[model samples]
Target: MSEYRSLEDKLNYQFNDEQLLGLALTHRSFSNVNNERLEFLGDSILNYVISLAIFQRFDSASEGELSRMRSSLVRKETLAEIGRELDIGELIKFGIGERKSGGINRSSILADAVESIFGGILVDGGFLNASSVITRVFNKRLEKLSSDDFMKDPKSLLQEKLQDMGEPPPDYIIISTKGKSPHEVFEVACISRVLKKEARAEGASKRKAEQKAARIALTEMDRDR
Candidate 1:
């Protein structure tokens, strides 16, 4: 009967306290009693679950490799991707201003909401249930992860490529930022002066924006080569 019944179905878990689910989907822009705390708790829970899963799945992986893979898996981009898959953006409760500014599709908001849902599940059901849900949701991603690709992020790879070509590293500059705290959107430009190339991108955070910009720059560089 709850409007969130569909989300519960996607998560494959029902909450005894429907309020918890509501809170998980509530953004700070919507209310003071939002999902930040839940996001923090869920971040930790997600890391643990993913770390354990990867550790077991890739038994031959070194510690450094495992760390890199975990970082890739737990990054905001990955979380945002998962959130999109679950259509979480549509369910998020945002403030009028945020909603008007397209907060629903914002990566940071989506990622935070996904984590908060995990936290809510932990609080409502227990670690077992929380882990079960996490594992189930991430099962395909875990299976599809490749050791060769997970070692380095886009930024790192771009930097290394530039270095190999005897070019200086790209500089990430914040072009502009919009919105208020916890819901801000940042536009960044990754400029490679030596290569005479530049790429611009927007994200919910500076680092994410820079990463995206770097990825674009990398793609352009590769295409030109």
Candidate 2:
């Protein structure tokens, strides 16, 4: 009960249906009836709620800008950060195998739990109630958000900068991969032949690693110039 109290306190919401909360906390590896479906539903709702909020808040922002901001806000890394704040990892229920494999700290699992919890809230109350919870969770982030966040992601920005400088597109190589699905560490190197620059970075996913590497390469190139 005390364990649940902490989660409820962080979310600032109580569940009328305790089963929904249980289901949300249950990972696929834990049970046959799990949170995957709820994750799917919650994913859609979260995207819509965030999109609407960004749309209303940034009246002067272009469509592309709004889209970019929404992407940043709804990304797995951002959601995982929010989940950690709520202590979702401590509350998650995993199978013995998953527990042994360190699923508790996996970013993908944490993010999925956040969304699954929202899906449960949506079912227990309604869209308005779920939206209210989302608003509470994302309030600080939205407040601190800047227009600069609306710019393209690191990878896209790097590509554009290189193209404008008449440099060839950067080539990404996977330096190494470690761990299993949903919790893997991917190290990637970004090399720009024309710029004679190379940078390496590691992330929880390959795409994220590539993005980080691109950011590093771009920073190095800027420094050289």
TM-score of each: 0.69, 0.69
Per-prediction backbone clash count: 0, 0
Looking at model 2, residue 183 earns an lDDT score of: 87
Estimate, for each residue in 1-225, the C-alpha lDDT of model 2 and write its tens digit.
655878887889988988898899999999999999889889989989998999999888766567667766888889999999998897889999998999999999999999999999999989999999999999999998887765568789788877877877889999899999888999999988755657899999889999888777665664453
The alpha-carbon lDDT assigned to residue 100 of candidate 2 equals 92
Model 2 CA deviation exceeding 4 Å by range:
151-225
- How does candidate 2 fare on TM-score? 0.69
Q: What is the C-alpha lDDT of each candidate?
A: 0.88, 0.86
Off by over 4 Å in 1: 151-225
Candidate 2: residue 67 lDDT (0-100)? 63
